[model samples]
Target: MKYQDSLQQASDKAAQVKLFLQRTNLAAHPINYAVSYEYISGYNSELCHIIEHKLLAKAPLDDFVMAELYIRFLAPANPQQEQLLQEASSMVSRMAAYSDVAAEQLDNYIQQLDSSMLQIKNLGADTPLLNIVNQLQHSTTEFRLSQQQMQQQLLLANQQSHQLRHELEQLKQQRLLDPLTGLYNRLAMQNQLDIWFSEQPGRRIAAIAVDLDHFSRFNLEYGNTIGDVILSKVARKVSSYVQNSGLPVRSGGEEFLILLPDVDLRSASEIAEQVRRGVEKLRFVSSRTKKTLPKVTISLGVSLYQQTENWYQFLGRTAEVLLLAKQRGRNQVANETMLAT
Candidate 1:
C-alpha cells in the first residue's frame, strides 16, 4: 500500500525483488521482499545506503540482518521506544565523556604515584615502606585494568548510541513524509521553506499548487480503496517532475504543492504544465475489475515569491491562482500573470 507505482512499474519491481532475493540467497519471505522492494525502488535512502555499504564490504545479508533492517527502517514507529532510545543515547554519551575524563585523571595519578615511589626508593626507604608502596602500586594497577575494561565497554556503548541516534533521525524523517505518496508532508514543506528563507534573505521561490479535478466525485464512484490507488499513482506522477531541485508536498488530501527556489514564474508554470500533461497521459486500470478507469487530470496555479509578502501570503496567492484555473476549467496550468487578465 505504501507503493505508488503503476501496474507495470510494480510488476518490474517485483521482478527485481525476486532477482535480489535469489542473488543474496535470502528466502522470499515477506520481510525480505519488503526490504528489497523498498531498496530497489530507491525511495528509502537510508536503507539503500546501509545495504550498499554491506554489499561493498561483502557482508552476509542473512535473515537476521534483513529483519533488523526492516524493523529499523520500515516498521511502524513506537513513540515510547523512540523516547527511550533518545534517553539512552544521551545517557551513554554523557557516561562516555565522564569515563574519558576519569581515564585521563587516573593516568595522571599513576604517573605521580610512580614518581613518588622512585623518590621513596632513592631516599633509603625501609622494607615495610617499600612493601606498602608496592601494594599501593599493585592496587593502582588493578584499578587501572578495571578502568580500561570499563572504557572498552563504554566505547562499544557509545558506538551503539550513535547508531541508535542515526536510526532515530531516520525515523523522524520518515514521519515527515506522506506514507502513501512518499512526498513531503505539509510540516516538512513548512520546515524546508523556513530553512530556505533563512539561508537566503529575499530569495525568489515559486509555488505550484496542483489539485486533482473532481476527486471527491471520483472517490464516490470508485470507492476509497480504488481512489487511494489512483491518488498514490497520481502523487507519484506529480512528484516525478520536481526531482532534486524542488520540494513536492502532499498539501491536502488530493492537492500537492511544489516549491521551487530561485525559479522564475515562467519556468515554474512550464514545469506545472509538464506535470499536468504527464499526469494526463497516465493510464489506470482497476486490477479487480479488469476495466480501465477514467483518466486523471490536474489543475495547477503557479506564483513567484513577493519580497513584501511572507510565505503564507505567497502560498495563499498561489492557491487563489489555482482556484482561478479550476474556475476557468480543469486540466490546465494557470500562472499569476493571468490573474490580472
Candidate 2:
C-alpha cells in the first residue's frame, strides 16, 4: 500500500506541473516544469506563493525570471559552507593567540640568557664559576627545547590556517557560481569588477551583453529538457570565445554577461561577434529521439566602461545596446559606436 501511495503521489505531482505549465503558458522545460511541480507539491511555500501571485497578474514566465526564482527559493543551502566559515574563524582566533604567547615566551627566554651571561661575569674563577657555566648550559638546553616545541606548534598552526583559508575560498567560489550553467553569477561579477577597479584604475573595461534569440519559443516547441541542453551548450560556446581575456557570467535566463578588461569598444565588439558566430554554429541533437534541433542564435550588445560612470550605469548602457540589437533584428552585434550615431 505504501509503494502504491508513493507512485500515486508522483503521478499527482506530474499532473500538477503539466496543469501549471498550461495555465501560465510556461514552457514545459525541465527547470520550469520542476519548479512548477515543486510549487504544487508545497515543497517551497514561498516560491509557490510568489509564482501564484505573478501568474494571477499575467506575468511572463521568461527563462531569466524563472531562473531567478529557482535560485532564490529552491536552491538548497550548503551546510558545509557554514561549517567551514565557523572553522576558519576559530582557526584565525587560535593563531592570533598562539602568536602572542610565542612572542612572550621568546622574550622570557631572552631575559634568562642575559641574566645567566651576567652571572658568569660576576662569578669567581673556580668551582662557582664552573657551576655557573654548567647552570647556563642547562638553561640554554631547556630554551632550545622550548623553541623547538613552539616552532612545531607554529608550523602546525600555519598548515591548519592555510587549509582552512583554501576551503573557505572554495566555498566562496561555489557560492558565486550559477547552479545551472556553471558560470559565474552576478555576485562574482560585482567582486571581479571591484577587484579590477582597485588594481587598475585606468584600465579599460568592456562588456558584452548576450541574449538568446527566440529562446522562449524554442522551449515551447522542444520542451525544457532540450532547452536546458541548448542553454548549457550556448553558455559553453560563449565562454570559449572569451576564455583567455575575459569573464563569462550567466547574468540571467537566456542572458549572459562577458566582461573584458583592458579592451576597448572595437575589440570587445569583435569578441562579441565571435561569440555570436560560435553560438550560431552549434548543433544540438536529441539523445532520446536522435533528431537534430533547430539552429540557435544570439544577439550581442557591446559597451565600454566610462571612468566617471558607476558600474550599474555601465551595465545599463550595455543592456540598452543589447535591446537595440534585438530591435534591429536578432543575431547581430550592436555597440556603443552605433549608439553614438
Candidate 3:
C-alpha cells in the first residue's frame, strides 16, 4: 500500500513538473534551467521510490527519510556507460551555453552601471548582500550544530534502550532463581518441566522427590541460622547431582526435586540410590566446627511422568513414593510401583 502511494506521488509530481514547464517561458535561461532541474528531480524520485519499496519497506521514519535525502542529492547517474558519456557531453554543451549567456549579461549590466552602483553591487563583505551572505553562513553553522546535537541525543536514547532490555532479562532470571540456595526455584521448574514433558511422548520419565533426613535436628543442635547454612549446602550437592544427571530444583524449605527425563523405574531407582548414598558419605565442615560434621543423608522417591499424567499427578505420585521411602528407612529410595518378577 505504501509502495503504491509512493508511485502515485511520483506520478503526480511528474505531472506537476510538466504543467509548470508548459506554462513557463522557456526563452528565459533561468526558467529553462529550472525545468531541467525539475526533470532531474522527478527521475531521481522514481529511483528513490523503487529503492524505498525494496530495502526500506519496513524501516523506521528517520531511516526512510534519510535514504530519500541521499537519493535526491545524487540523481544524475546513468546505468549504461555509453549513455552516461553522451549525457555528460550534452550537459557540457548546455552548461557552456548558459555560462556564455551569463557572462555577456554580467558584462552588459556592469557597463550600464556607474562606479557607485558597481561598488554597491560588489559590496566587499559589508553591504546588504554581504550581510545577507554572512547571515546565511551563520544559519548553516547553526543548522549543522543542531543536527549534531540531535544525533547525540539519538545515540544516548539507543544506549538507554539497550540497557533497559538487559535489565529486563536480568529481572526475569532473578524471578526464576532461588536467592538463598542459588538454584532454580519452583516457578522455574513449573515452566521448564511443562515444556520438556510436551516435547516427549510414549517415553519413560522420572521425577525424584528429595527431602533432607532429620533436617530439624540442625535447628535443635545449633540454631535456625545454622540450619539455613545446611540447607544451602544440601542445595549445592543436589545441583551437582543435576549437573551430572538433569536439573534439580529447590521446591521449598528442606525439599528438592530432580527430573530424569527418559529413565524408567529401574534406572531412576539406581540414580535415586546413588544420590542417597552420595549425601550419606558427604562431610560438611563449618566455620564453627573444626572437625567435619557427622553423617548427612537424604531420602528419595523416583517416579515416571507418563503421557497421560498431569503436573499434579506426577508430583503427587512422587510425593507418595517419598512417604514410602521415609517409612521404610531414614535414607532409602522408593519407586512409583514395586518391580515385577
Candidate 4:
C-alpha cells in the first residue's frame, strides 16, 4: 500500500510539473526543469505557491527571479542526497561500535597478560615461564592488530563525522529559511531571539510587526494567485530593509516580524517606516493582461523590548501598536513613541 501511494504521488507530481512548464512556456533547461519539478513535488509549499501564482497570472519568470527561486528551493537536499546521508550515518554508527568492542577486547587481553606475569613472578619464576611468555607474545600481536583496526576505524569515523556535520548544518539552514520570500521563518526568528537574549540579557531588541492593509479585499479583487504574488513581493521588499542588521520573518500569512537586536525604538521605527514606503511604492502588473494592480500598502507597529517583559508580552505590545496603526489608518508606522504622544 505504501509503495502504491508513493507511485501515485510521483505520477501526480510529474503531471503537475509538466502542466506548469507548459503554462509558463519554460524551456526544458536543467534549471527550469528542476524548478518545475520542485514546485510540483510540493516539498517547498511556499515556493510552489509563489511560482504557481506567477504562472497563473502569466507573470514574467525572468532570469533573475528564476535564479532566485532555484537557489532557494533547489539548493537543498533531494531524495538521493538524503539516502546517501542515511547510509553515511549508518556506517559511522557501525564503525563507532566496532571501535568500542575492539578497544574493550584489547584491554581485556592486556589484563590477562598482566595477571599471567604476576602469577609467574609470585611463583619465583617457576610457574611455566615458557608457556606464559608464548601466551604473552600471541596476546601482544593480537592487541597490536586490534589497536591498528581501532585507529583506522577512528580515522574513518572522524572523516564521516565532519561530512555529516556539514550536511546537517545545510539542512538546518534550509529548514530555518522561508521558502516563499527566501527570508527566515518564525522558528528561525525565535531561535535567533533566544541566542541574542542568552548572549546579553539586557540586549536592546526591537520588533516591527507588519500586516498588509486590507489583504483580504486585495485577494478578493485579484484572486488568491495574484495575492500570493503581492505577498511575496511585499515580503521581499520588507526583508531588503533589515537584511543587514536584523532578522526578517514571515511570521505567518500576510504578516511579518523584524527583530533588531542592539537597536533603539527610534531606529526600529525608522526601519519600519522604510519598509512601509518600500512596500507602498511597488506597482504590480499582470503579465497575462498587462493590467496594473491596485497600489498596496502595509501597516507597521514598532516596539522596543522592556527589561521586565517576556517575549510574548513584547510581541503582544507590538501587535497592539500595529492594531492601532490599522485603526488609525493603514500604511503608517505606529510605536510606543507615538502612543505616548
On lDDT, the candidate that comes out on top is 1
What tens digits encode model 1's per-residue C-alpha lDDT throughout 1-341?
68789999999999999999999999999999999999999998978987886665454576756865776678876446767767866776776577567667877887888888779888988999989988988987897788778768766766776677677678778867878889887558867978998999888999999999999999999999999899899999988899697999987778889999999998898899999999999999989999999999999999998987655566668878998999999999999999999
Quick one: RMSD of model 4? 13.0
lDDT of each: 0.84, 0.80, 0.63, 0.77
Instruction: Please list all clashing residue pairs in model 1, or write none if there are none.
Output: none
Per-residue lDDT of candidate 4, residues 1-341 (tens digit): 21233767878877887887787676767787778777666667878777665554443564445655676556656446767766766776666577667667766867787687667666676557867776887877787787777767776776676677667667768867878777787557767878888999888988999999999899997899888888998988988888566998877567888999898888888888888889989999998799998899999999898988666566767777888899897889999777766
What TM-score goes with each of the models? Answer: 0.60, 0.59, 0.53, 0.54
Q: Is candidate 1 or candidate 2 better by TM-score?
A: 1
C-alpha lDDT of candidate 2 relative to the true structure: 0.80
Order the candidates by TM-score, highest first. Answer: 1, 2, 4, 3
lDDT of 4 at 60: 50
> Which ranking of candidates, highest lDDT first?
1, 2, 4, 3
Q: Which sections of candidate 4 miss by over 4 Å?
A: 1-167
Clashing pairs for model 2 are 29-224, 64-253
| Predicted candidate 3 versus true structure: per-residue lDDT over 219-299, tens digit per residue | 788778877887888788777766444778876567788887767779778878878877777777767867676577898
Candidate RMSDs in Å, in order, are 17.9, 8.6, 29.9, 13.0
Q: Which lDDT value does model 1 have at 125?
A: 88
